[model samples]
Target: MHNEPLAYRMRPRTIDEVVGQKDVIGPSTALYKMIKSGHVPSMLLYGDPGIGKTSIAHAIAGTSNLPFIALNATTSGKKDVESVVTEARMTGKVLLFLDEIHRFNKLQQDALLPHVESGSIVLIGATTENPFHDVNPAIRSRCGEIKQLKRLTQDDIIELLEKALSDEKRGLGREKIRITKEQVARIAEGTNGDARKALTMLESIVIASDEEDGEYLVDDAIIEQMIKRVGVFGDKRGSHFFNLLSALQKSVRGSDVNAAMYYLAHLLENGDLTAVTRRLLVMAYEDIGLANPAVGGHVLAACQSADRLGLPEARIPLAQAVAEMCLSEKSNSAYRAIDAATAAINKGQVGDIPAHLRDTHYAGSAELGHGGYKYPHDTPIGSFGGWADQDYLPKELKKAEFYKPVVAGEEKKFAGIYEKLKDFRKK
Candidate 1:
């Protein structure tokens, strides 16, 4: 009823009241089933800002009838974690919710593992970062992860606006503000599907237009003015950083070398050399692997050189590296190969390594016939008579070759070598 931001006022008090994230909260979903059965595990909720990661955690805390404690990883440390654990020991079961858990360094994350493992605290961690890349493996392993998606569609934003406007306690329905569908759509489009931004903008319009008149009406002009004043970057700070990076990555993935270079330059202009260098290094491996292995080495060298040189001098090497990577014969063969191999291993086809390839360096190794293997170079055609025919590749993937080289620059040479090797194997 009081003057407060719509986003805060409309915060869902119950799981059923929460908007969007049906994938996680839908009937028969893992979290839904867990909450229903009172068997919720320590969880790591990851997503973009304003996607209800914290709301879900809060809903769980409230509904589960357990003691809930919140900690901000940016401010809290090992001492705070230990204190929470101590409190939980005496208070029965408690949920320790950590926001921005990625900010916690390895030591701080390690401190929480013991308590989570012992069930002294049910850890609910929220991170805007990708857990696969940011969270330590030990901490990630101990918690069930729920990935919340970004609000991508206009319909999703509208749903949120509807929820905000209809709720009497939180929305502007009490002020007799009348907003048309067009105004809602305009606000949603301007906010780029961010529910919090949309709601906040709507609240601002309501407050600014609240008059002694019969009714306050929202139009496109008001929405556009607010957008320009607030700027498209929105209240959520990290959006610009991620949005720019996403554009840069998509440019590379699309093979628009010119576009990629431009994005790289934009980041550099903004003094994001470190971020540019790191992404280029990752792109070298993740997007431009094996098809051009030299790209990765070149990227690493560029990064090291930049560290030594710093700034203006570093920008040259960074530019060279990014341009070279963009212009190189791009292929994700290595990425595919590893993913396929990992999938096979997960399916439990992790057979032993070939005996001949096993260790033969230790003393008394000859007694076990470790060094008894024939050398490939000693044979004709530089091979040990098809001795490399061991089943290193899984049976299911015997013919499932992941690395199909594109006929581009150096990749053409690799293709030729592969052909020659196959011919030799057949012989």
Candidate 2:
């Protein structure tokens, strides 16, 4: 245990010592109440990486005074599980902690059903994925209660790191390293509220700190060296990922090229090429609209290149698309047009398709008066910008205007013809 990394050695042994996730293991929490009362049923703990799923399992065993047996689903086989079952049977009571329980295939997971159902082994299953989607149905059924641990807050991470700094038994108290609150907060925020990350980062810094003449100093320069390990969370699904994507788009719309590129680089660094491609595609059509319609094609080509090449090399086309998107004249006319049209329909303004606009290809369409489309190509005045006086909108929506272009890029040219058409219709 003394040879263990600071994070592993400092794993919370008692419920009271565990930091954050109060919503899951607080004194008033149901899971806590159950464990304290010696009612240790099978439980599936689910959440992000570095959350307290494993520590909570240890706490459960400590509170119950039950024998603790740890196994990782990633490596433990059916024989290993059977060994645990035998130990539980022999001892009469054991709390079995299975880390990454979702990694257990159906057969391996099914092996524990009998032991867990018999009450000989109290199962504590931990998984980062959603249990319903990953764990076998039988195992998940037995683990009826699922306690979800949330990402640690920045304050929670800071407090845990501070305790590690002072605790001698399992932490760096003997080393006597000094870290400012701002420095601690910097590590905490950079870790995205992951306690293990924050603790490990602190440990790395302390190990690498060097004595200058008499005392060891940990300054911004050293911190920078250690924090190179702190990286963007590369999750494809999560609020954090979407938040970054939203920031990238808004930066483009706001014409902040640097900010847009920064976010683009962050996602790319995290191996989110697929998500970047999809988001850039949406941004091209929704945010750039009529301002630079051709940018839509460029964005598509970038997406294609990203899909074909993947990362580092793919970032070239993605960066090109991002630069163009940020530099191009911006408009949301197409997006607004759809929204306005939808609003009109929702408000009961929808009417039957005009007879002339209805299908005319069927054999009897002409007899049903659905073949009289204006054929604007043959208009007497001209084709483009012609037929200015036509009322093609549904009767109730004839006077409604859904697309109003901003005076930018291609939309500026379209705006001229649109205004003229509107005036002609009014006359």
Candidate 3:
């Protein structure tokens, strides 16, 4: 237990050594300025895992050069909160760094509120959940400010890995192993912007490499093995499941065939058929909608087919659908159009439905001018047997046009028809 993991040993001691999240730790930011002046206040740091929430807290505590108490909110209750408060009063100044602060119940949070407000304990709370939705409101109110941490980029991860590989006191420098830039980058890429995961992976790779004639050599085989294991050797339904699903959706929507397949493999390997099918269906409609609504039917068919077929065989149709979606011309016309109309309704820009479009079957509806409605089949207007010139929208919103089709996929033809008719209807 005394021998700490490389990630723990390599934790940044100061803000200057912290990589990435320049938005929060950059010289120009309020947190950075305060850290420099050693006048930090209560703050809540929330973001993805392994993105240095603890490192930042430690740096703040180290900078203050005051008594620092680090506690995990998962295990620490009101007793611990009161203990910290009591000690802060005696210690003059104390930095109380709480990990997984969202785990602290309302009572636990309230117990620490007074010390924070009294300037005895500068509270630094960290959690992976969104602070606004999960953190106790009272604690948040007194936290003064919140700092959002971002995922470490490939370059950032590589730099941190390099430091870990070379640092003697805090890294693997004493191991006498040599590593290439490409290997470090590969390790960084595998973990998906998680510094701790990347470092742990590097340490594993180092331990696994062979000592060839006293020279520990990490070759391509070791790297390839690590890659394959990292992609598939995790809990399928873990928190990272959403991350994989999101990656696949975005990859297909962005038309990146390679990335789409990469994430698809992760999703399929996890055997989460329902989750993948649901998100793919959403992407087909929300992203590929209007442009090619017919593809929406195809996605539905594929999902249904996969559900019946089950895994190993189910992935084939899913892969085919993913490829098609990646290659499909993209458009979000339906998404944009609906959102615009919804925004209007939300803002009170809507009016009652036009009388002509209202139902006439009710007792008084026919007598209330609903009988004047023109049947679209009886009066042919557009290419379809529909009445385009009739006032379907209420008078107040007669000129409100929500959809503007893009010239992509099947929408080009729809756009031509809409463009030709919308202008004449407004007159």
Candidate 4:
């Protein structure tokens, strides 16, 4: 254990030592109460990487006083689960901490279900991917509340670092190392709320620093050098990615340019140009719609240019599109209208087309009452836009009003024309 990496060695051995994730493991939380009672339920923990999912599991194992065994879904299979189950039978109950549980295939998850159900194995699964979207339902249904561990706050990271720095057994306390509060704070913020990353970086800086008279001093220069080497874990295939997209769209819809740009930056940072472009195009039509009809075309052109350019260059066009959308006259009249029409159809509100609107090109159409279609172009009315007022909708839905236009941008003019047409139809 002394030879292990600082992050691994510093993992909390008891619930009292676990940091952050107050939402799930806080003293007043149901999970905390359960652990204290010594009867732990099978649960799944999910969040971003390095956010104490495994640490929480370790804490649970320590408090539960049950046999603890570990397996990773990526490498462990049905046989590995069976091995655990076999041990569980001998021990009467084993706390099985399955890491990366999202990668467990359906068959593998199903095999573990019965043992979990029988309480022989108190399962605690940890995943970076969202269990709601990635985990098998059989396993999901059997687990208790799917706990979401959040990124540790800067203070939480600082507390963990302080604890590790003072612990002689698992941490680097005995060594005559010197680090300032600001330097430690830099590590906390630079790690992006990852406690493991903070601890590992501190360990690296201490080991790599030059020793003078057996005392290692860490400064801003060394800290910045190490911080620059840390990679931001951009999760393009997880729930965080989708959440960012949703946030971007909603911000644009609310006409908040700054908020929209903020989310766009996150997506760009993640390197998902396709998602950014595609979502922007959808927002143009879905939110801007007839209010600023030209925006749809502009967004499409921008998206096309973005797809061709890709990356760093793509961000320019994407940013321009997002900004334009935020400033545009917002309206969802067309979007809501189409959705309302679709809902009616979905509920069996559809009706047969009137004979005048039915296809008449077929030879037998004349015999089936498919004729009498008035030509609006030729049989024009006086000044009602050179139109013949006729029921285009099916007879059963002739009075159904789906396209309720809004008074916004170009749609405002369209709404006036719509009212005139309705009056004309009455005659």
Candidate 5:
């Protein structure tokens, strides 16, 4: 116990002892039931650091009476994976927990699939990345996914601090420290809802204090100094990145060009460029779509350029692309159109493709009456009124215009082209 780090020494030993994450760790939840019944499945625990992902794993091991073998995805490899699986097989039942599971490459992940499928080991993978995106589909499909949310409430942190202050063997209680409610609240707030960070900070404060008569008084000023020394990097894990990206996307979606650029610069200042580029590409399809299809191409080009040029020089093109996308006329009509079409298909509303739209280049296509379809291009108005198909879009949506040009730059030209096409279709 003396050899254990203060953080480990203070680790929660049971789900009941774990603080926060009530949504996942609540008494009646599936996870809680699994721990109680000792039938826990292979799971992926995703959350920010110091938010009890690892602690929860340990607690599960302790409660379920399973052999728990921990693996760091960073340092472990195929040999390490095989060794663990071999041990688990020999032991007959084992829980193999992989921390930072997203860091595992595709090959490393593939090694676990057979063992997971065979029931020799129950895999508990923990990651800070979005599992859907970072974890390979094959590996992700085998495990139950649980999202552990970052601590966001001051009360949550305060609860943790209170526990720390009272726990004699592992916490500040051993130092005979005297902490006011105000000091506790201040320290908790400084921790930003992360219990591990709160406890560690509290321990630091106790160690740094000069004691008198075995009683050390903690103050807000000392906590503030400790926080300054720690520095706030914001959550590099969880949704902090996505939340900011969502704000940036909404700004672009709303056509607030300046606001979009500001968000882009903020990401560049503190976040990853590859992530920024990926989101920009998504915004291209989700927001711009067919209203200005070229916008997607422009975004892709910016991403390529950013990769080729890198940083300071790359930021130039990324900034230009984001500005263009924001200022461009906004439309999600095409995006909505596809989603509506897909929903209909899933519900068995799909019909045969219109004859004219079907392939006529095959050897027997024309003989089968496929080429008899009217050619819209050869018609007087570049459309054949007699050409027929079920109207996929609802009449209201078909007539319901979505993209309204902002009466500026190239967008006005786009509006003009759309007006001309609308008239041509009517004719």
Candidate 6:
């Protein structure tokens, strides 16, 4: 235990000490109430690493006074599980904290189902992967709501670091460390809300520093030397990456250029040029359609250029495109119109084609009453503009209006033409 990592030694022994994730383990939360009531439900906790999945398990054991045993699924097989089961039987009930539970194969997972259902082993399974996608349904069904732990906030990490510095038993309090709040905050920021990384980095810094007078001094130079680069949250395949994409789009849609650029930088840092480009092109059409039609062309050009240039150099054009999108007149008229038309078809609104619009050039068309089609180009002058009175839609939907053009940007011209056509059709 003395040789254990500072992060391990500083694990929260009670639920109250568990920092962040108030939504899951707050005083009034269901999980908190359940635990306080001495009812420890079998559960699965899924989230990014260093977000207190194991600490929560330890806290559960502390609070409920249950015998706790931890086993990593990657290395432990059926025999290890059987030993835990034997311990549980002898002890009446045991809290088994299984890390990387997703790595358990079918047979290995099957071994836990019976014990979990019987309540002999109060299971607290933890995984970095989304449990729904990775955990077996049998195990999932036996577990209660799978609580998703969130990455600790900057404040949470700071609080944890302060606690570690002051804790003599599990921390560096006896070292008489001298560090500023700002320096601590810098460390917190660099860890990207990962408490384990923050604690590990803090421990490393303390170990490398020399005592000045009676206190071990930490300076900006030391910090910079220790933390080479700040960790960026979200990988290409993680849900966080998609969340960043969503944030980028919403910021652009909301016309907050500053926020948009911030998320864009996050994506660029993640090194997903393809995904960001695809999303930008999509945004141009879906969110800015018809309002500023030329914006789409500009964005397409920018995407092509960015793809050709490739990142570092690519962000220049991409930044321009993002700014253009953020400042452009916003409208979803074309997007809504198409979706409305699609919904009409989905609801069985389609009717037989009008006779005048049916095929008439195939041959023997006059006998079938398909000969009344009038070409708009052939209309006489004064009624020009290639306009002609025609029933293009089937009789059932001759009056159905789907394309309600917004009168803004270049779409105002389209709205004017639409009104004129509607009047002609009425006449």
Model 2 lDDT, residue 222, Cα: 70
Which lDDT value does model 1 have at 121?
86
Clashing pairs for model 1 are: none
Expressed as tens digits, the lDDT of each residue in 147-191 for candidate 1 is 655554678788888777876767766667788888888888887
Superior candidate under TM-score, 1 versus 6: 6
TM-score of each: 0.61, 0.70, 0.79, 0.93, 0.65, 0.88
lDDT for predicted candidate 5 compared with the true structure: 0.76
Q: What C-alpha lDDT, on a 0 to 100 scale, does residue 278 get in candidate 4? A: 81
Against the true structure, candidate 4 has what lDDT? 0.87
Model 3 residue runs over 4 Å out of place are 16-23, 26-30, 153-170, 173-191, 209-220, 232-254, 262-275, 310-315, 347-370, 379-383, 386-390, 405-409, 419-427
Candidate 4 lDDT tens digits, 52-156: 989988988998788889899999878998888789889899999999888888767667789898888888899888798888888888897798888999999
Top-lDDT structure, candidate number: 6
Model 6: residues >4 Å from true position, as ranges?
71-91, 100-109, 127-140, 210-215, 225-228, 359-371, 380-384
Looking at model 4, which ten-residue stretch has the lowest summed lDDT? Answer: 380-389
Better of 1 and 2 by lDDT: 2
What are the RMSDs of all candidates, in order? 9.6, 5.9, 4.1, 2.2, 8.1, 3.0
Q: Write the per-residue lDDT of candidate 5 for residues 1-427, one digit (tens) a residue.
A: 1455567777777778777787887797877887798787888887767788888888888888888899999999899888887888789878888998888887676677888888778888998777877877777888875565665478877887787778788765556787789888888877766777787888888777767887887766788998876644344435557767888999999989889987787677664888889999999988876667789999999999998988878889999999988877666655765676677667776455545556887798877666455544444543333333233244434554444444344556666766776675677
Using TM-score as the measure, which candidate wins? 4
Error (Å) of candidate 4 at residue 201 is: 2.0
Q: lDDT tens string, model 6, 1-427?
A: 1478899899989998898889999998999999999999999999888888999999988999999899999999899988988898899999999998888777677677798999998999998877878888888998986999989999999999999999888888777788999999999888888888899989888777777787788878878876775557667867668878999999999999999999999999999999999999999999988989999999999999999999899999999999999999988999999999999999999998988888878888878988678888787536345767878888999889998988988898888888888887777
Per-residue CA lDDT of candidate 3, range 1-427, in tens? 1188998888877778788888988778887897789788899998878888998888766666878899999998789888998898888878989998888888786787777888888999998777887788888988887988888999999999989887988888877787788888888888878888888888888888988766668877887787777655334654457778888998998999999999888889888899899999999999898787878999999999999999989998899889989999889998899999999999999788877777887798877777567766777765655664578778899878898798997899889888877776757
Rank ordering of all candidates by lDDT, starting from the highest = 6, 4, 3, 2, 5, 1
Residue-pair clashes per candidate, as listed? 0, 0, 0, 0, 0, 0
What TM-score would candidate 3 get against the native? Answer: 0.79
- What candidate 2 gets wrong by more than 4 Å, as runs, is 117-119, 178-182, 212-215, 235-263, 272-275, 286-295, 301-376, 379-427
> Which runs in model 4 stand beyond 4 Å of their true positions?
362-364, 379-384
- Between prediction 3 and prediction 6, the one with superior lDDT is 6
